[model samples]
Target: MPIQLAHAATLPAHADSVFLLPAGTTQLPAQLADLHEASRKYVTEQLAADSKLITVNHYSHRHYFVVASAKGSAHLIAEAMRKSGHQLHALLKADKVTELYVEDLSESADGALALALAEGIYLSAYEFEGYKTDEKSKKPAALTRVLLTGAASAEAIQELDYLLQGVCLARDLINAPLNKLNATQFAERMAEAGDAAGYQTEIFDLPRIEALRMGGLLAVNLGSPEPPTFTIMEWKPENARNSQPYVLVGKGVVFDTGGLSLKPTPGSMDMMKCDMSGGAAVTGVLYALAKNKVPIHVIGLVPATDNRPGGMAYVPGDVLTMYSGLTVEVLNTDAEGRLILADALAFAKKYEPALVVDIATLTGSAARAIGKEGIVGMGTADEVQLLALKQAGNRVHERVVEFPLWDEYAEHIKSDIADINNLGKAEAGAISAGKFLERFTEGTPWIHLDIAGPAYLTAPDSYRGKGGTGTSVRLLYDFLKNQE
Candidate 1:
């Protein structure tokens, strides 16, 4: 989507949709009588009758203003909107209408303006067109432009631009159909995007896997026809030429069929395309960091693969050696994310980063624990880093709640034939999964995000849509910016 700036009067003539701030129920004084009457009778009156409390109808050119009453005292709603086909304006090709908007905005002078710009771009760029055909469209084209009502300073503009870039990259990755976005292809796309965004990149094929003896990755790739790939992205700011890097690892499971263990019919295998959301998330983060020219040294490690029940798929009772030389007994083939991440975590350790953070759509138990509102995380050390992530998440509305990685949980993975097992017993499944990955982190200050719930959404709300939520990108961006 393209971002544009315009004066309030010129906006109505140029935009397919116009957003406005309506006067409050008791706030607008009687002196501005005529203007207040138009706002209250037309806008607030309509909003009060609806439950979603979102859209307010306007007869002129099908424009709508989203409003809410609150303390901050500005009518910017939320900083989000979107355009969809078959809407009133789309039917006439009068340019796409802004489909979503927020009300009750902050009046703070810092990040508020930029956030508003980002909100507009984000709310307007979403589409869910993958499954339907009989109707005009289940999805819509990308939002190509946005018309803003206020002056966004240069710094605010840059911040908003980078935020939108992160969101767009995530939307593109999640919005892709499964057939086009498996492991190898994802790596290729990231490489291309990295090149264009000015980051140094490299990819590891199956041969390199064998050379490096990345047994965990090799074991997971035994099923799919598409080969597995490991991708590395590096960004060193001009000023940080001598500093050690901050590393991030993301689990890149493109499609998970639960391997030989398999999944249930009601499991919704079709949405597995979004299983690589963590990878897409980090990829988006890298794009933003570079595009915004953040003065920091960074490295991103992605271990990519597919888990299918092929003829030679790794099966139950199989023992696999990992890059860390630790052997894992595959008690359940469906428990495959930790196996792949073990190799990637070990690989990241060599860089000796100031910190290592890995994000994965690892466990459904996490969803059960934290629901769809926040990310569930477990860090081996550094309470401060974890707390900082929590604060950042809370501010962005992408929250993270940390769990304990108790050494006692390792008892579940204790195996007679190998060093450990991929998964523990069904109880405490989320924490045990974190324990499994913790083994591979050695002693680094690390945070493991089991983003099973927040990674995908079934409906649109706030600034997020019904598909991939791109859950952690914004929080990660916020945290990184703090170090600077």
Candidate 2:
């Protein structure tokens, strides 16, 4: 929730708490005195006592402005709020401090806004309490409302909403367990979300999949009773005219049991639900854009399926034809994300998008290269688009460290039977995976985000919760907004 404050007359005279100040208002002499005195007391007396300056306001329905100890304090507050099941937006509206400006705080205002917004999302995120036995106690709180104050123009608020929707969508998708959100159910969820967001959505079932000859999707679905689905969501601005569409393709491997190359029992088989993080990321961004009404034409494609080892599961060394009609020699059934994405990437040519960006938790090599931070690899010979992506990455703090697509790496995919092989050697796995995807782009400006590292969380942090990190949503959102 964006913070809001009550009228001055309604606030307590001696509350002595640092009330949030909205952005852009000149402080009155009395208000300034109160803030000054509170800061000093907290710094000197409170620090010495080792006591927190917690504001205990209950009577007022709206939040009152109190200076945060620091910008990071908002995140701390959000963590506490999450545990207590209190919506920060309710307090923000009550406090009337959506846009805060403290002369003493040196943090960048924009960065603070980003942090505050992300923290709010963390606090408002829903957990799957559906199957709990203690029905009464297990009911989760609803953080449905938000209020932003200060010099927030309509456009700024829209942008904020755009980002929030992205985060919330990702959280919902990630929080759902495999039983409830398999490949088919996930496609329905995306379709529903798209419909609600005013985007045109189309889902390709088994018949259409066969018609289109999406062999990778079909191959992956063979082990499961549920058929594969390829979903596409299109968003066109009312005011937009003949602008180049931005195509986003995501790998929706809902549960990857590695097919015939099944993972060990010690490995996290259940967490495979999040294997579709790349698809979720793109879907969330599209939802955000529609919610905020961002004036850009976008098409989001997700090739959804589950890869389980069963009687019909594709085996190693199997050759499958993608939508591009380019045959792939599958050397490792576990290396499936790129196989799905290749079909989507090939289909991207229909839109003739000026830029195509696909995201996937493609390889552990990406995690090794950049750790929990994301590593971005683009394969457009166009230097200008590459530089723009790099700049966009830096500005949004979804910092992308680029890896080269040298000719040497291309040789790894050369196959004796088919045009290309799905799996290369384990060495340089991340680069080879990205290089594998570049083959289908057909020279269109493209970027492949290997977000395996940042997509899931091993621990909780200020900006995100444990489970889904909602990686790459804001970075792409910011890039599209900039394009507008």
- Most accurate candidate by lDDT: 1
| Native-structure RMSD, model 1 | 4.8
TM-score, cand. 2:
0.81
lDDT of 1 at 188: 89
Q: What is the per-residue lDDT of model 1 for residues 43-156, given as tens digits with 9 covering 90 to 100?
A: 545555541122333444344443332433232233221221112123323344543221113233442533453454444445544556666654445444443444444465
RMSD, candidate 2, Å: 5.8
Cα-based TM-score, every candidate: 0.83, 0.81
TM-score, candidate 1, is 0.83
Question: What's the CA error at residue 58 for candidate 1, in Å?
Answer: 7.5
Best by TM-score: 1
lDDT of each: 0.71, 0.69
Specify the poorest-scoring 10-residue window by lDDT in model 2: 1-10
**Going through the candidates in order, what is the number of backbone clashes in each?**
10, 19
Q: Write the per-residue lDDT of candidate 2 for residues 312-370, one digit (tens) a residue.
A: 88999899988888899989889999989999999998898989999898998888888
Clash tally for model 2: 19
